[model samples]
Target: MEKQELFKIGDVAKMFHISVGSLRHYEKFGLLKPEYTDQETGYRYYSTRQFECLNTIRYLRVLDMPLDQIAEFLRNRDVKKIQEMLQQQKKRVVMKQNELQIIEKKIENRLQQLQDTLSSELDTVRIIQTGPRRITWIRNKLRPKSYLDLETSIRQLEKQQENTVVFPGKVGIGITKERLLKKQYETYDIVFLVLDQEDNYNGIVEELPNETSVAIRFCGSHADAPVYYAKLANFILAHKLTITGFSKEITMIDYGITNDITKFVTEIQIPVAAI
Candidate 1:
């Protein structure tokens, strides 16, 4: 058959090393469309020229672009518009690269620290058995401009709780999935209360489950968490274990709680596969 002749879905699927189901899925998602359809046979056919278009859809989807937006862009197919979209994507990728670099650096530093700690006779690793505890905490939405406000708000909460004599656990922070995907820095909650306590501290109290593993106490600011994460990730990989959840940042020293980044000492906890 000549190159201009249309190929059936199965034919194109085989040629592209993709499953027929996948092709249908792309179509269903509005990411790809067959150039022609035989009403009688109910078969889908695509020209060879459509291969490039299909591949473009696949490539964009790999980058996590929404199919609706992809379809809109394809409909217009304006060179300038496509370039603008690509530039935006490029910015996102660059930001991700920067974050990865930061993570890599932290991991390197943590590895060295681990080696030093292990080798030093005076420095001993402790495996602490911690039970579930109830914590009273407040979750606040944090913006980049008001990042400093998070500490201030948390400190105020602590003071208010202390005055009211409410349940108190280690102050902890949580990151939402949305922030992670957008590369936006966010602090979802600053919770306080022990994990297995019966008393609810007048504030919002959350009961956290017990973590069974060695908890390393790192004395450092928020910036130190990244390094700790890197160390923890390395440790998990080295020991052939998987990190089961998002790591936790637990404040070990509050000194009556302050937002000063320099004085914050927190714990970065990661649940792992048992050795």
Candidate 2:
């Protein structure tokens, strides 16, 4: 019988479409090994016999199975055991696929929000009817002094609500009627996450019902919120629309959407009189 060809590390990596370091990583984790190694030079080599094992390792990795799991599967080499491992990996893959779908839907929603905000007339107030929405939120009466503190609190809220909000969650905040009336633009009392109606989540869920609202979608960072709030207040007064609820500030296009402060859209909505 003819001897099968032996491949060097670089050649094996190319054949596997993986980096050399990855092969080294696999070997370090004991998930795979070269068929032969030179004792004196310490050079590794792979042969046809190792090819099937290497391919199996690669397949398991693509399914996101941990190295330890793969190593255990390889060491056992039992049909039932390997089948059980593969079944668990299949469940993980399906979960990831479902997560990706959720993420895609979130992207679509953000894009639609951006399109709608950009198309609307800047600084113009409009009275529009909005349907009911449920939100899971964290409220802080005293706003933080620094961005770091604010971010830390936000992170804590997310951690607390990790299982409460679905993947790719949308965050928003609310300013009180007193604040808008007093021009306390930077002071936000409540921070909330917008929840889909069908989302079965646990947390402080608040239902905002349908109402005619005086809303102004403005483009800029939160620093510009005060000015837009004033604009919205003026529009409400001019149209004889009485403020009916705590002003809701929806971050239509927030820091999550873009890095440009000018592109961030803050929609100030205040439920108004039906007339």
Best candidate (score: lDDT): 2
lDDT of 1 at 59: 79
Task: Locate the minimum summed-lDDT window of 10 residues in model 2.
Answer: 160-169
- Candidate 2 positional error at 141, Å: 3.9
The collision pairs in model 2 are none
What does the lDDT come to for candidate 1?
0.57
Cα shift from native, residue 130, model 2 (Å): 1.6
- TM-score of model number 1: 0.39
Scored by CA lDDT, what does every candidate get? 0.57, 0.73
lDDT of 1 by residue, 1-275 (tens): 34359998999999887899989988887777788888888888988778998888777878867677788888888889888888888888899897677567655654664454335332122334446755555555543222244456556555644333321124456444344333333344333333323222455655666754434456554544544554555555566765443335555443444455444445555555565
Candidate 2 matches the true fold with a TM-score of 0.77
Q: Point out where model 2 deviates above 4 Å.
A: 1-5, 142-156, 163-171, 177-188, 196-202, 221-223, 226-231, 237-240, 251-264
